[model samples]
Target chain A: MLKKPPSVVLASFRPSTYPRGYASALHSLRPCWMVFLNILILIVVCGVSSAVVLAEDHLAVPANLQVFDTPNDGGQSLTVNWAPGALDSPDVRYQVLVGDAGATDVAALKVVAEFPAHTRLVKDAKGAWWTRTAERNWHQFTIRSGKAVELKDGTVYTVTVAMLKGEERIVGPLLQAAPTPNWFNWNLVNNLVLTLIFGGVVFFSIAHARRRDIFLRRIPGLDAVDEAIGRATELGKPILYLTGAHDMSDPSTIAAAVILGRVAKKTAAYETELLVPHRDPITMAVCQEITKQAYLEAGKPDLFKEDSNFFITSDQFSYTAAVDGIMLRKQPAANFFMGSYFAEALLLTETGASTGAIQIAGTDSDHQLPFFVTTCDYTLIGEELYAASAYLSREPVQLGTLRGQDIGKAMILSVIAIGILLATLGVATQAAWPQYFLDFFKDVK
Target chain B: MDATIIGAWVATGLTLFIFSFLYKDNPLFKLAENLYVGVSVGYTIVKTYDTVIVHLIWKPIVENQEWTLLIPVAIGLLMLTRYVPKAAWLSRYAFAFIVGVGAGLAIPRTVSSFILKQIEDTIRPLLMLVPGEGVTFSWNLMNPASSVNVIIVLIGVSSVLFYFFFSVEHSGPGKMVARTGVMFLMIAFGAAFGYTVMARMSLLIGRLTDLIEYSDPSYGRPTLWLTLVTIGTLIVLSRRSRSEPPDSH
Candidate 1:
């Protein structure tokens, strides 16, 4: 119970916070000798330093205490480990106590976790060598903010592992650590490798496209673009076009806008009316500019109606209702539903279908693909929507990017085949080596 | 009638008018559609006003003294310069900044989350290692993660990837794989259609239940009176339509 600043008896017990290596580092100085030497030095150093004394000298102090920041996390966590002491038993409980760094008050540390000895040991942890200890089967525990003192990022915390036998308590030397925000997570290295490979492929493909012709197979949905515009022109009716409900930020919406330029060009050449309704103001503005540019390129700038690409309500069903109203009243000959859609996809496409219009839909949102496929005369599947622009514009850069994406997909397919073969062989042989391949592809930690 | 009953009658009347679209487009349906659009737009404007002007911009600048918010606010205002013909070029700066930042931020996350994660999931192993029973190939059809289902999924995914490969032509073995991919796609769509039909039926049930509740004597039977009023209005409108000349356009 002698708590008069136990720094005299326990100050030497302070293990250096930063360690050169994680094993056999903490010096296990005898408590009796530490007290004798600490007093001998403190008597010469100062009276206040020698004021403290020891309690329960026979209690076994655990050794090799280590506290460090949890690696590869967003921070705010510290891990603690201490070797199993001589008092380690099945019924004996181990309590992990924590406090601010340089805390001298022995009783002030808060116990964050209490568990039976031999439980939560390094041996019981994951079978990775990185997680194991080289010296002893040390008891391990993680300290986070909750049910204990808050461990903030960039703040040092002192952790001590204490063993409890009934009412008897014995604590290890205090170890300090500070949680820090790590800029990069090494856990997602596999994902990074895949991304780098795909990026390199894209760049190489773009460069190669400069010299050679890139072959692109036919997309039936894109092929009907001309036919749909021609039908609207021959019928002397306007073409109703939607640039989807999303803002300009979405890739699907961007693709839709690019395809809109091509459609506007075709309509400008054939002298057909085009109506582009938008749910987002930004997309409306962007599409308006695209339509104008398309018309100017086609030598018919006068035909580009500024009001043709208009903003309806941002609310989904309200936009749907307004579009349905326009469909009924104006009676467009062909309808184009492009970009990402939500529940309103079926509502718009179904109404367009009932009107007997030559409907062609394109969207990357797989959830709405079923409705579009059923309701529209021609439907572009997921990747086909992205490819629609390159198919229409025949631009080298865009075509190269599309071909690169296909190559990436091919790489992925090959991986799946190889992964399956590896996994099958690994299972059949009851070997652990296949885990390296599996872990390399594990997208989630 | 009480205001609650009156509101109920209006709501039921409007709902019925929207339902009248199944018959044909008419003045009643158009009235409901216009009202819906107007109310929705009004609600959205108020919400944006509260969130953007009041909560985000005004309150922070006024109370918290967050002057840095005005930098982005100025950039947003720059987008409005497109209306001024002389200053129209300035709007490109705002558009460029937005598109550039949005694409830069979205590309990596999209690759990691959508592309990489999808590949990881699609390339799963065939056999499972059961702890006590060694390697086991489960044939349980009910378990989606069973070995048989894993092989099926592998085939489905591979064939689909092959079908979408634009660089390669669909011929010989590739054609058969493409056909398989189409079959899988159709099956997925059929299941989705069935699910949607069930969802739509549930929505219908909910509406019908609400109508039944409004038909209670406590609510003064708004559903019954509204239906009669709607039917009477439709009859009168049709009679007038029959007398007048049809729209040429």
Candidate 2:
């Protein structure tokens, strides 16, 4: 058909001239022209840097994923294995990622394991990485799944593996696996040895705890808590307790919690005020529980003022300042420093010493002990803090656990002596006993 | 190189000011201690605002628009209720949540990492002499260690574990085991104690080294000026404090 003249077409366009209206025609035509222009731009842009961006964003999963049992847990965990990505990093590492279902976006990925480049060999398989890949065609990675994760019983759940080059791109063809309960995970071999030792300690201790006269030695540092409290009561002043700066998650802080229980009880019985300044909010909460329990046990629950235990700042130095401020203001007659401490240990102890408070410090932090020893009236050495709960609570479970630890220590000593003998013998006669003896500690590849 | 250097100087001055405590109670030490405390608290407040409030709370709630975070947000708010004495007990609910969650997390991890992992690493075959290997026996190429080292490691790990075991009776075989454990425990303790002593000595040495290093002109004639200024200031302050009545607690 011949095209109409532009002027004629325009002049004919009265409001009612065209039944289907000019607006739709204009709208449709403009978008088509704009889309064409966009296509041209995209083609040019893609042509310029297509290779680089494609290389950066390319992700793939290896074809095969092997699932197996993990050791120690009560039949819950699985170790997953995957082939390494095709373009795996020379310098960086592969992070094993997992999710509940396939087709889930990569953003919701869970990190299963991070394997260093040098230590790529799995404990179960003894072959070299090259040989293993030749035989199985799958590079191995281990994922530990606890009882907490439940993929549908019979349904297939997708597993994806990605290699992260530090904080950069996660490159992979995502692997998918349908996890079934595996009969054996070769990793369990190592776990089996550990379980035996743990059971041995617990078993022997529990058997020993049955005896009537198990002589537990006195820890002078722990024994002085009472004396410290007594002195504070005599001086007509409050007792201050700092449970270190760490949250209750720290073992040292837990030890502090246990010590606090004893101190709280003693303070309650003596009708002396107890002041606990905390650095962590969680620890402050734990201390409150311990204090209440102590007061309740002492039959003075009413005297237990919750506000006496305060949450200071969570910052290390700030917490130190706040506690020091309290000490300078109150001049508490006795200070109990327990749990884990850092640089603040010196600062707090010095302030306490200056105030003439009889400070009893207990912590597993070796670095802080010098300051504690120099300034505090009494200090618990390494592991002494761990012993406090057993001393105070006398719980068989706790006591049993300690006994296990003791047994474990004894076995270690006997070996050390034997090893020393072998070393000396080898030196004296140029024998190979040291080398022979040292072989046992090596990791089974 | 900029504020870090100035900060280092400030830190050095403060450290010396505090160390002056070893000689005698002094005002310069108190001033440094107070400034340290104030600045540290300020730093913490800023960090907590940036991390816990911003990252853990506000980002998740507002930026991510995750409404479920309201529970934690409410609990965090309850923790601040301590400023109000009457409603202070309300904070316990927050405390309970934190403690409960923490315990739940810790027990399983502790059981696995420390207790289970330690035990797993300890036990080994009583005899690791692999037959038909060699005249003297060889280290297992498949495993990390030779047989003898395995036994020694097992012994070390078990004995150490035993020494800390406090619940059982120390009699008969138990006594024998306990005694062996104690000796092992002592040696380990000794080693640890020795290392600790070394570490503390190092720190003392480090502090002294820094003090000496400050004598160099390149870093500035810091030691001389710092010592003289701090001493002079302390002397003045001590005399003033003596003349004035002590601040009552």
Top-lDDT structure, candidate number: 1
All models: lDDT?
0.83, 0.67
- What is candidate 2's lDDT per residue for A158-193, written digit by digit as tens? 555565555665535544555455455343343345
**Model 2 chain A weakest 10-residue run by lDDT:** A127-136
After superposition, candidate 1 runs with Cα above 4 Å error: A1-180, A429-431, B1-3
Question: What is the TM-score of each candidate's chain B when compared with the real chain B?
Answer: 0.93, 0.73
lDDT of 1 by residue, A74-144 (tens): 78988887777765777688888888888866687888889888688865654333223334377877787
Model 1, B1-249: lDDT tens digits are: 578888888888888998888777888889999999899889989999999999999999999999999998898898899999899888888888887877876676777677666766776557877899878898888988779898899989988888898878898999999999999988988898888879978988998998999999898888898889888988898899899998896
Model 2: how far is A158 from its true place, Å?
14
Model 2 segments more than 4 A misplaced: A1-221, A235-238, A292-307, A317-334, A342-361, A364-387, A393-445, B1-9, B81-90, B125-159, B169-183, B193-223, B237-249
Docking quality (DockQ) for each candidate? 0.57, 0.10
